[model samples]
Target chain A: MLTSNRRLVVYGIAGALAIGSGAAFAQGAVAAQYRWLTFAVFAAIICVTMYVTYLAAKRVKSASDFYTAGGGVSGLQNGWAIAGDYLSAASFLGIAGLISQYGYDGFMYSVGWLVAYITVLLVIAEPCRNIGKYTLPDILAYRNNPKAMRIVGAISVVTVSTFYLTAQMVGGGVLVKTLIGIDYEISVMAVGVLMLAYVLFGGMVATTWVQIIKAVLLVIASLVLVMLVWTPYGFSLPAFLADVVGDTKVQAKVAGLLGDAAKNMTPQELGQRFLEPGLYFKAPIDQISLGMALVFGTAGLPHILMRFFTVPTAQQARKSVVWAMAIIGGFYVLTLFLGFGAAKEVGPGVIASIDAGGNMAGPLLAQHLGGGPDSFLGNFMLAFVSAVAFATIVAVVAGLVLASASAIAHDLYVGVYHGGDIVPPQQQVRAARIATVIVGAVSISIGIAAKGQNVAHLVALAFAVAASANFPCVLLTMYWRRCNTGGIVLGMVVGTVAAVGLTLVSPNLTYPKAVRAASQKVLDGEAAKRSAIEAALASGDAAAIEKATVDQKALDKAVTKAKDDMKKVEGKEVSIMGLEEPLFKLKNPGIISIPLGFLAVLLGALLFRDKRSEELWPEVYARQNTGILASKATSH
Target chain B: MATAPKIDWNAVIADPRFQALHRRKQGFLTGLMIFSVVFYFLLPIGAAYFQDLFKTKVWGVVNFGILFALLQFVVAWGVAIYYSRVANRDFDRMAREIAADYEKGG
Candidate 1:
């Protein structure tokens, strides 16, 4: 009875928040481009990973092996897996796509994932390793009231997992659809089946190896990209950047993001402005919201926290973070080169020609740098990158499924449902396999349903949930003795509700403006004239198509009329569920939800005042502090 | 009957070696975090308010924001490397010494 309320309230709020953004993206703008070579390369990568799964499955025996790879993974190896799981397609493609299109705003996206490791290093990882054997719930249950702790922990884990998994799947499906001519539904399900097979059979052991392989391939890809981008300019970054300064073409290309204000500026001034601040984060609140979410959210992600348990000891867990930071930091530096190089070399016009959404910025940049479209270099590089991207998505999804499945089997089924420690390891492992399939199926459905949504935005919402629901509970448990079971439970619920609630009402998730149809523009003879030009292009001089221009007065009048209507509706206070205008002004909910998460923890601890939480504190504290529990270490 | 581990958290906290380890980890982390937070905020805050300052070129063709953003990666790597060194030489050694002391009932 207590458990059901936790799951219902948390998932309910999160589900509602996701629906609005998912619906807005349903009208995806990117056209699918089928490349058979990309398909063959993708198939080869799949074959290798499936073979790895077979090897891992042969060794799997117990639940301990299922969740943590028997705690035998070395520091650097676990570090590689962490990097693999952490750097999803969002980092590889989304960052490049965004950077090539948006410039400085795009590079800021990668900084968070890099800086997030600091939080993981100094704060969460060691204590997590010391206390939790398998799931986030294990740490939460270390103190008072295992039932209460398990309920909220399970809820928080599943909520984070589902949102994060849906994001990876969405990116996987859409990018695959765009690169190869596969349908989005088929691509999503293909990813789902691969993820399910890995977790259900290979479990954590195979998942770790797959992550390590993907991470290595991705880093190598990033390095090669940096070299390719620089090779055109005699490998001199300064020469390339300076060369971009006076180019009227590159300046005009970035003009849309710079706004109409830049139209009067000289080309040099325009170039300088692109490198200056405020391309993306123009507001102080938006910047802070982004920072808070990235830093706190990374600390709270269930898969990342679970990675610490794979290492033998707390010390190695700490070392793994440093390794992740090194890889991530270097990767972001290379991304800077890619983003600026794409701006100077590929240009926005070329980027738009490939994909309107800029999702192809990285892959297309690789192809362009290799050679023009018709060349073997271009075609081959594109296929190679597509394979790496598909691998990136698979590794991320496998991790998500594993994390979510553990939350279900280890936390919910064994810890809560079957009663803790009474259920055998054998039974729990089987339950986890079942849970993986169910989670995989649901994620695939959401991915297909949410196809065309912006990858970075979907991911930011997931971070907001993690920052709000998970960070506070985990931090308080590590530091504060006063933190009660009720405190964490209340914190998780409040944080989830607040983050989801604020996100739903945020301006970022607003329904895109309705297009005033072209049928209405026929009154000015514009549509008729355009059709005439199109007909001429088919039978007459192709250059004659250049004579087509819409009647400016009629178009301007339509634009003004639409703007006035939106202007009037902008500040109007509507009901909570109304979609016409957002209730919250900020694009991100982190600035509000993070503090609320902490507030709920404080309030609940003070209000509920469970003596049991206080009593068990020293024992949990002792273990966490010195790494000793019940006459021995917990695990490696 | 299974025997529980004999533990004394108060003694551990009081141990000089433990205190040194704690002090080192906490101090380095606190300084690093503050430096990171302040340094990170400077990019955005400068970008938001002092746009003109970041627009000025310090080296070659790169503007101030570019240098500042690039420096973020360097500082992150430097801090991590520094932490790792301190952990291997000082903190880990202290941890082992404290554990040995507790085991010997010293």
Candidate 2:
């Protein structure tokens, strides 16, 4: 315990050192923009989280406490923590930016994410908590041959968790770079170290409190910012909308994107743009696909599921989920406004200049509405927003790291390597910390490689993978009576491969390459025309030949220039125009892939169905009976 | 020819701490669930109505969603606490009663 405390302190100091060095080296807008009060507030939140972890740690008498908070957590706390875990930087920051840029299409993410909770309630959450030990593998291997099933389960867990972890790390780097102007790699390293400290020293106890504090702080910050936006205009919503509508650039963009017909549309029509698909009638199908990806991907996330185990009962699990959904749903709705408000106030040109992807919309909006970025109030708000974004990344990454570490140490090491022999609790904790370091290193490496990529898109890819791979296997094991070990293993592999393979080859992945090629082609054509024009003047010829040659050159130049300009405009227009269709098509492949996984499991079960002992059915029934009795006996 | 297995009441109610823990957990859970259900339904509508009344547009939408989510979590926490207290209390009482009966050889 002392060692754990000491390690936590050391890790905290290391984080401060990293931040301090980065702050000192930062230049221009970021250097003078540091808000001491905001940093202090962020630090205070971390300290509070640490204290919560200490309390939890004191109660951790067994591996159960470390892994599942002894299954004693209340529904409300667990619910908030789960929400905190699920609302990553992508959802908190990315959603609003997306809404601002894409109109109604962006709201699809919120609906998809919120709806996933229903699936969780129906299929995965309660059953998983009821049966599993520390990880999903325990549930998979519950009745079937334990050895092979455990190994297969571990592999699935590692694959999904690693991909998800990479996305969080990449987001962390971007958040830090945007907020503090630090080197992206350094920011990634800073987040990795902080997360490593969190999981290694504090374990789940630390991770949970960090999430809870973050959720509260995020809510408070967003509310305060929204209130401030209203304060300057006497708290009148009509006045605010009038101001937003009066902005010429915002009006122009709205008109251009929505068409002339949108100018006369009602507010309800405007709001509905976010809710219904096909509102952007001219947009490609990828836009619709992107919307679906955001919506469905929320259900299959691993970090989100692990949070349910912290609570004691299935009922608490259910209630907590309800709470998490409400909170998450509310947050996403706010993001839509934040995105639009920033676009209206700051102007799209400025936003595009700062970050073409629009991840900085929230902070940029704060600066525009509150004061200029250099003003004291503006700087403070900027710092606060940056700190919130940073904290959001850290909180989410910590949960992801813990999930991966548990999969390795608890599921793989104990379940597979030791043949499920009972290991001492202390040794298990030690192994978990070591696993954290290994996962942390891998995350840092991925983050470095993923620099300059869109964090949200990468996160969506992670979601697609989780939905296709882990969700099917876990869902089937819980609900399907005929599912055997072979079925679970094969389904996980097939789903994982299908999702990853499709995502790689999908038009969405290849569209960027095509755009780049188009740009190069335009540039090359211009160069060739210029060289030919210069050569035409140098060559001497007969009058007839020269006249024909000059005419040909002029004609060729005119043709080349027209084509080049067209290509340039087409490249820009098509890049934007082609955006929605490819993404929508790419995203749906997961829906098909997920069902395909179920079919794989069903087939495997049928093939292996006859091998089942009659004893298996009775044992399953007995376990259910005992579980019910246990619940009743305990619930006074 | 066949005998039913005897009930192990002693095993069922052996732990003294279980009752107190169970009761506290139940009370906490009941309160939490009630709070969550009420707030979850009310808050989103409240936020939406408030946004509509004020015409806050983008900020209004964002706030409504965020507040709803936050309120739901608060309710979940309340429910979890209620269940934990009830479960601990009932289990402890049963355990103590069984232990006492065993001591008396009843």
Candidate 3:
């Protein structure tokens, strides 16, 4: 009777939330077509995912089984799952949008991401699997002070996970709103509930299989879509280029888009920008930076790394990574076509009209080429794509929650509470599930708060955090024996602060008004006046234009003052010399903050090296041997 | 002088079955790794560069390359499983052989 009462309460709450969500959906002016499919797909995916989780739970008999899938998952399966996890909506949608806007510079993301895996395979992969029990803190604490490592690891996990979770939630909302006529908040809540259910019930086993299925589907769908695109265009690279070059509007847009990239360009460079077909080959440095963030960030991601641990043996790890690389690489190549095809077929005007956020290009393409939104194929594709996007968010969120749960359960709670004595497997698993619900709730709150923010941009902030705080400590601990807990902790703190602090203050985070105001004061006074004049001209109010010119000198002076203030705040030279200077100086500093994190770790290690044991050799040797052996076995 | 604690030499190397199993596992994993490398790096580059010869548009060639890459991934997975089974068998055999040799004390 008590159990039934509890069940009733649970169902009642769920029913209320669903009802509320439906009301919100109706009020938000969502298209009915988008709503039905999204709801159906969301329900279907959640059900299937939960069933998979149930199977995993049934199989769980030990801590090892729950935490690492008993290290028995095949390498190939783990690899696909890893790729699935790594290739988020941000990568698929965001990169495509970036390419549509930026051109060749966009491919830099592909290079950065692919090459970072090389570093992972060589340096981090085997060692991480061998030494770390669950979370990164496990490995760090193994050699140093547990108390400090736990605190730092928790901070790192929470910080990265928070940003990642928020971005994914935003993505989920966008997916719902875009595909299934629903309110953004309701979509976010729906995704949150679905993810919470999966993590709480199924755990890592469900997470892995879900990721694998999604990865396969994403790859296959992309391939088919790319073929559809080429069939119309005749598949000739040079011919495609010629057609693109022939479009004067495209050339003008490309030139406009390149902005600063054109400043120091040779004729050939300028010509190439106008001539390029897909913007896969030529773009500006900022675009390059964005790409680097995507690519290099992949290796440093905690969620992706955790997937490797689920597979048994170093050999399996190796196999999984190889498979992941193949799938991910192939998927990226297909995205190029998708991006270009969208540009060709849907046209940029439609994209600009749908959402200025630029993340809707791929779905919009599916709608146009497959058939309009009302067509069977089109609606199905829309639902499928949106579902995939939602699935991507759920899969990533599950990984984040799991990582946080592990950090709490394995590192903090177990390490502190049990003093390394093995906790009962069932108890530990229960603790992890509880942790998942807690994390899920917190993430949902954050997602609701960060309404309407660009999901991709938010994800980049997570990457910046990961690159700054976690990457440094992980790398130093693995390679440098001199690194002590104090150094690792301090370095992580410093890195996290620098990256997060800078990101918060940067133009990306600040409101557009603040950015414009800040920029005006930093540049020259005359330039500021010129901008005001231009604004007046654009508005085409002759009376306002004449009046604006009378105070133009004053406005110019204010602009200069603003520019100077911005320069002072930014700690870089601001010149009226060109618009590019302020933007470049402003942008580079944020990204540059990431490397400072690496330096902090190095400094910390150097300073604290003597305090640690002289014979750190034994532990280091053990870890290295295990890593190498695992790698060799997996690589075989 | 006291001999170094009698090393378990017989226990270390006596199991031919274990070696065979280990070798099979190694072979399988190695094959998979090779496939992954080719699929990810070599094939994409080849297709991109030689799209004209493939008689497909560049994009089509790239798509084909991806298909091949997916295939390679499957192959790599198969090899990994084969390797794990063989390697575990070999390790077991080797351990048994070593124990037997130690017991015989030849």
Candidate 4:
């Protein structure tokens, strides 16, 4: 390992060089009034995290140290880190926006996310800690053909991480651009470089600390907003919720968003509708499908699973998960108040007008709570929240980079290429740092290329693949005695193919141009009819005028019907085949792909018998349960 | 880089204490796993089929659905805290003893 002093000098020079170049490149004149405050907050966050990374860099000595902080992370610390790693900008902002706009459905949407940890806590966390070492493939390759298992494991981890990373990168850039007027490409590069620095120098220690800091900041920021919103109702949740569902102003504002759909409903009816489930999701199956994905998919996410290895023992792993559950569960619960609070105070129409997706609801609510945007307090709160959001995205992306890098360097480079035998630890750590750079570069490129595209579906796609592909194999490898190397490979391949294939043919792929043309046709036809009616009325003959009045009434009704149809079609997606409707109806593939994955594993095990794998079952079982031969904490 | 010491894993697996610890942990985990899974899925199922039932107000503006959904967070924390306690109290003790047996014998 490099001496701490030498490493410090190298990192200092690199940091100085980066700061100089970043200042030169980010000199674009941003128009926001509070741009200076935002930049200051951003700089402060970076400096603190980099300092933490510098300290962590001194401790990273071996491959294990680089990957798992030498297994020295306490249960509480790792628990907070997992929360930091798990709650991306999506959960913090996206879910809040959903609830703010969609009402009760949005709150319901968050329940599954919290409950997902039950899977992680009950089924996966302790066993994962007892079984795996550096990467997830460690568990799979233990009793099987190590080479094939490692190769497949690396591929799956990289694939899942890449999808997840792209979403975060794009979201980070877009969020920064919207909040502080930074250029999207520049912001993406900045996020990539900062994440690379964390993993390259600090490794898991830096990444974990970064996550902990971000998670704490995020919760504090959210708590502030929730408290501000609830203060009006004397901090009573029931009173706040009562106003959300009973207030005439809130009901009217939300009902107006539904347009003609709520025309006949009374204010009380609309208030009740606001707290009902069907307001956002027309189909219940979509909710159920997404729920399945979140609940199962969380257990299989490589980044989340990697957290367990940071703890010393299975019991610590279990305790860390419990801590994570409390924090995560509490955060999701707070989202209920935040979402409804925004709807109550900021108004859904106002939130939607700012960002159609409501991604800015949290920040916007912060601004509204402080005052209006014109006030200094409002702008300051906005800047603070925007900074926290930036930290959130960076922390998540850093974790993603570490996960993919470990999979590549630990599983593929060391395990597969070197046959898990003679690779030196320092060289392995070097390979991991190199892998981090490559993963960061690739994700940055993908994020830039995918700029301005609707990438919301990629998040769902990532979860679905994790749930279907990785989860089944990992679950079976531990629980099923008959599961073998052939079974794992087949299960991963089949599950990945099924999930991706279903998404490809599903309504996720839509012909926007054609939909626009169809809507234009309706508008144009209506315009022609309107001119004809005008001409008839202008002729000033009593008979023709009377006839024109009747036709005008009919035309008005038809126009309203046509406009509503167009509105519905605008949100609905079509398959890439140019079909008006998708062959596959469900947006998420978890309900279908998960079972197919399990079935494929069964089929593969029955077809290809591996005596060696069968013979190792006792050892694997004993170790996974009792932690007899499981990898121990690395020595300094 | 020390390799793990070799021991008779089959014998360890056959040890009565090891077997009992495994059995109890698995039984408890399986039961909790089933309960949590079933309890969790009820959210979507209730939302999908029994909309009115879920909408029945329990308190001021807090409907059965919202209450039920919020209850999930409690249940999750309860499951996690409860499981961790049982695992530490009953399971971890037994596992340490079994591991100690092997450490000495090997």
For lDDT, the strongest prediction is 4
lDDT of 2 by residue, A511-609 (tens): 544555655665566666556545765665454344335444444544555565455456353333455225435544555666667787787777775
**Please, what are the lDDT tens digits per residue for candidate 3 over residues A1-636?**
334433533553366347435645442112465557655765576556655766665665555566677667897798888888888777877766655554433443444455446445544665677666567776677676777788788778777877787878877677657655667777677667766665665567777877887787778778777888776568765555445444433443454456566678654344345323234433234444444454345556777777767775655666677677677767776776676566656654445445544567777777776687668677667666766777787787777888877777777777766776777877887777677778888888888987865455567777777777777778777666577776687778887887666665544543444555657545644655577678886788876665455445444445655665465546333232322322332332225656777788778766775344234434443333233223222231
Superposition TM-score, candidate 1 onto the true structure: 0.86
Instruction: List each candidate's DockQ score.
Output: 0.51, 0.05, 0.06, 0.70
Please list the Cα RMSD from the true structure of every candidate, rounded to 1 decimal place.
Answer: 7.7, 11.4, 9.9, 6.4
- Local accuracy of candidate 4 as per-residue lDDT tens digits, A1-636: 447544653565466436424543232212355677776776777788888887888888789889998888999999999999989899989999998888888888888888888889888988888878878898889787789899988899988888899989998888777666667887788788778878888999999999999999889988888888887889877788777777654575565568678888887778777787767777778778888888889998999999999998888898898888888888998898888888877777566655668887888888888887788888778888888898899899999999999999999888878888888878988999899989989999998999987688888989999998899988888878899999999999998999888887776765554556766776788877789789999999986686567567655755665676577567655545656656688898889998898899899988998887798888788877887755443434
TM-score of each: 0.86, 0.74, 0.72, 0.90
lDDT of 1 at A32: 22
Q: By the DockQ metric, which is better: model 3 or model 4?
A: 4
Candidate 4 TM-score to native: 0.90
Model 1 off-target regions past 4 Å?
A1-34, A452-456, A512-576, A629-636, B1-20, B101-106
Ranking by lDDT: 4, 1, 2, 3
Report lDDT per candidate. Answer: 0.74, 0.62, 0.61, 0.82
Docking class of 3: incorrect
Candidate 1 residue lDDT tens string, A181-255? 456776776677666666777889989988998898888877888887777789776677787665544576556
Residue-wise lDDT of candidate 4 within B1-106, one digit each (tens)?
Answer: 3755676878888999988988898899899988988898898889889999998888877789988988888888888889888888988889878887785655
Better of 2 and 4 by TM-score: 4
